[model samples]
Target: MLERNEALKVIHERHSTRMFLETPVADEDVRAILDAANQAPSAHNQQSWRFIVLKGKYKEELADLVLSKAADFPKPSSTLLRLASRSIHSAPVIIAVANTGELIARGGDLFNIKDGSGVDFFRIMEIQSSAAAVQNLLLAATSLGLGTVWLGVLVLIKDDILKFIGEPKGEFMAVIPLGYPGQSSRGPKKKSLEAVIKYFVDE
Candidate 1:
C-alpha cells in the first residue's frame, strides 16, 4: 500500500493516455491493478464487477468487432466509433470491465423487489459499483507507472463486446487500454476547485 501523500500524488498524476509505447506492461502489475479493483465496495457487497483482459490478437479482434458493429450507426456516431476503435491499437493491453448481474438478484432479495419498479435503482447501484472498481484500477495503474484511459465509448457496443468476451449476461462498463505512454501529457484543463464546490451552514 502507498503512503497517504504518495497515493495523493498518484491520483493527481493520473490522466488519460491515448498514445502508448509498444512496451508491454508486466503481468504482476496487471494482477495488482485487478486486485485493487476487486477491493472496491459494492452495494450490499454484491461485488458484481467482472473483468476481461485482452492481449495480442484479442485486442485486434475486439477492435475489429467494435469497428464492424459501429458501422451500422448514423453519421457522427459512426465517425466517433471508428476513431475510438483505432485507439485500441495504441496499447498492448486492454481490460474490459462489466457488471456481472449479481447486483440485480441480490438487491431484489434484500429489498423484496419483484417488479421493474426497483430495478432501475439496482441497475444504478451496479453501475456505481463497477465505476468504483474502475477508478481503483486506474489509480493502481498510475501508481505502477503505467498509462491507461477509461474508454466508456466501448459500452455503445456493449452486448457485442460482452458476447465476444464470453460474458453474455454482464453489462459492459468500460474498456481500458493499458501500456507505457508513448507521449507525455499534462492533462486537460479543469474548472477550479472553488468553482465546482458549494457549502451550506447555519447563520
Candidate 2:
C-alpha cells in the first residue's frame, strides 16, 4: 500500500517538463526505463517496439526533419507548431518509439483470423501496447527524478523519421524528449475522476 501510494505520487507529480536542463540523463536510468518499458504486454506477445535514442548531431538532424516536414502539413495552429519545433530541437536526448509494421501486418496469420478482416484488431492492440510502453517509461523517469515530455509532433513526420533512423521495417509511434529540468513544473491540472467515469449496470 505504501509503495503504491508512492508510485501514485510520482505519477501525479510528474510534469511535462518542456524547459529541460542542458544536462543529459544518465545512461543507467535510460536502461532502467527501457527495462520497465519492456515489461509492457503486447499483442500475442510480439513485443514489436524498437527505440532509437538520439543525441548530439543526430538529434539535431531529426529535429530539422521534423520542422521541415511540419511545413508540409496543414497548420491549424501556428502556436502549437512553434511549441513542437522547440520541443523537437531542445532536448538533451530524444527517444523515438517505433514498431515493426511487419509484425502488425502478420497479425491475421498469427492470431488465426480466417478472413483477415481482424488485422485492425491486432494493430489496435499493438498500438495500445506501445502506449503502455511509453507510460511505463515516463513513470520510470519520474521515479528517478528525471523529466520528460512526449513529442506528438513527430507523428506528423513519421515517414521522414523512420527513414532518418534507418528503420525500414518500423513505423514511428511517438517521440519523447528527456533531461533534467531547466525550469520546474507542477504537472497539468485534471478533471476529477467523477467527471470522467461512471458506473455501468443493468437498470
Candidate 3:
C-alpha cells in the first residue's frame, strides 16, 4: 500500500500532459500500468478491458488522423492545435483502450442468465469496468513518474479512429495518448472539490 503522502503527491501532481519528450515508455512500465489497471474492481469480477499500444510510425499515423478529423470540426483556438501538434510529435507512445463486450459468467456457470440479458448486463459492466481501469492506469503512470493526458477531443470521431486503428466493429471504447510530458503543458484549471461534491448523512 502507498503511504498517504505518496498517494496525495501522485494525485495532486497528476495533470494532463500535452507536450511530451521523445522518450519511449518501457515495456516493463507498460506492463506495470496494465497490471494496476487489472487490479481495479469490476461488477461481478468482470474484467473486460483491452488495450492496444501504438508507438513509432503507428503513433505518428494516429496523430495525423486525429488532426485531419479535427480540421473538419469546430475547434478550440489555433494555439491549442499547435500545442497538440507538438505533443503528438514528441510523445513516443499512445494506447487505445478497447472493450470486447464479452460476458463473464459467475463461477463456471454460463447458462444462468437469459441470452440477451447477459450481453446487456456485460455492456453496462464493460463501460464501468473500463473507466475504472483507465483511472488506475493514469494513477499508475503518475506513480511511475510518467505523465499522461486523456484526450476526449478526438473521441467524438470514434469511427474514424477505430478504422485507423484497424479495430473490428464493437471492440473499442477510447484511445489515450501516453508519454513523458514536455516542459510546456500547463494543466488545465480544475473546479474546487466543494463545488463539485455534495454530502448528505443522517445520524
Candidate 4:
C-alpha cells in the first residue's frame, strides 16, 4: 500500500482560519498560492477567476469600509458583515476574487447554440471555475503553513467592496484572508465517505 502523499496531507490539514498573528506573509508564498489558484480547471478553459491581493493600508481601508457599511444591513446580516470585517483586520493578507464577467460563449462560440439564450448557464460555469480556484488557493496556503479563511460574507456587500477596490468586473465571489495563525484549530466534523457517497453502476 502507498503511504499518504503530501497533497492528501495538505488537504486534510486545510481548515478555516479565522484568527491570525500580526506577522506579514512573505510575497513569494503569496505568489505561490495565487499560482496554484490560477491552475484550477474551468469550463471550456474560460479561466474566469480574477484575483486582487490586498495588503498594508489598502487592507485596513477595506476593513473600515466593511464595518461602516455593515450597519446599513439587517440584524444577522449586519452581524455576519462585522465578522467578515474583523477577519480582514486580523489577517496580514487578503485576496479578493471576482468572476470577470467573461464566460464560455461571450469570447467565442458555444456548442452550436449562438443566441445567448443560455447566458445564465454560462454564468454558473464561471462561478464554479472561480470556486475551484479558491479551493486550490486554500490547499496551497495550508501546504505553506499559512492560515486562511474563505470569507463568503464579503460577497454580501460586493458592490461597495468592489467599487472601493476599483475593480470593475462581473461579481464578487469570495475573499480569502490569510496569515500566520495565532491559535490552533480543531478540524470540524465531516460525514464519512460511505455515508455521503453512492455507487451508480449498471447491473
Worst 10 residues of 2 by lDDT: 75-84
Predicted candidate 2 versus true structure: per-residue lDDT over 13-122, tens digit per residue = 67787767787788888889889888998877888888888988998887777666656667654445556667767788888888876556877788778697886787
> Candidate 2: misplaced stretches above 4 Å?
1-4, 77-79, 201-203
- Spell out the clash pairs found in candidate 1: none
Candidate 3 local lDDT, 125-150, one digit each (tens): 77888889888888889899888876
Q: Is candidate 2 or candidate 4 better by lDDT?
A: 4
Cα-based lDDT at residue 11, candidate 2: 79
Report each candidate's C-alpha RMSD, comma-separated, in the order given.
Answer: 2.6, 2.5, 3.9, 2.0
lDDT of each: 0.88, 0.79, 0.72, 0.88
Cα deviation of 99 in candidate 1 (Å)? 0.5
List the pairs of residues colliding in candidate 4.
none
Clashes of each: 0, 1, 1, 0
Candidate 4, residues 128-197: lDDT per residue as tens digits?
Answer: 9999999999999999999998888877888987787677666888888999987998569788888999
Off by over 4 Å in 4: 1-3, 104-108
Listed in order, each prediction's TM-score against the native is: 0.93, 0.89, 0.80, 0.93
Error of 3 at 165 (Å): 2.7
Candidate 3 runs further than 4 Å off:
1-3, 76-86, 104-121, 184-186
